[model samples]
Target: MNNLFHSLLVFATFLGLLWKIHRAFRRASPIGDGCVCGGELCLSSP
Candidate 1:
């Protein structure tokens, strides 16, 4: 029982970390804009 509880706690922590990383990446990279690899700039629609 204790082992199961420990495993669940660890898994929950891992998932929380993953979510934070995903959010950070999304915030860093805007939609419809390719990564900063010298690619053509995506013009915003008026």
Candidate 2:
């Protein structure tokens, strides 16, 4: 039981971290811009 609980906790934490990173990336990148690379790597939208 303890092991299962621990696994769930770790999984939840990982998911939370991933969600935060996803949000950060979204904020860094503009919407409707299918580009992940920011700055010079990304092309300017017309």
Candidate 3:
């Protein structure tokens, strides 16, 4: 019983770590847009 509980805990931790990594990657910008900094060059961009 204890072994099963420990395994589940380890699995949960692994899943949590994977979720954080996934979120980090998903939040990154691939467009490299200068509008992120509120620049004048991108002011005209919709």
The lDDT leader among the candidates is 2
Candidates sorted on TM-score, descending = 2, 1, 3
Q: Which residue pairs in candidate 2 collide? A: none
- Model 3, residue 38: what's the lDDT? 54
Which parts of model 3 are misplaced by more than 4 Å?
29-46
TM-score of 2: 0.65
**lDDT at 29, model 2:** 61
Worst 10 residues of 2 by lDDT: 37-46
lDDT of 2 by residue, 1-46 (tens): 9999999999999989976785577676666434554454234542
- TM-score of each candidate? 0.64, 0.65, 0.61
Model 1 weakest lDDT span, ten residues long: 37-46
Note the Cα lDDT for every prediction shown: 0.62, 0.67, 0.64
The alpha-carbon deviation from the true structure for residue 4 of candidate 1, after best TM-score superposition, in angstroms, is: 0.2
The C-alpha RMSD in Å for every predicted model, in order, reads 8.6, 7.6, 11.4
For 1-46, candidate 3 gives per-residue lDDT tens digits of 9999999999999989976774465457564335344556444544
Report how far residue 25 has shifted in candidate 2, in Å. 0.1
The digit string of per-residue lDDT tens for model 1 on 1-46 reads 9999999999999989976775566567765434423244223320
Off by over 4 Å in 2: 33-46
Between candidates 1 and 3, which one is better according to lDDT?
3
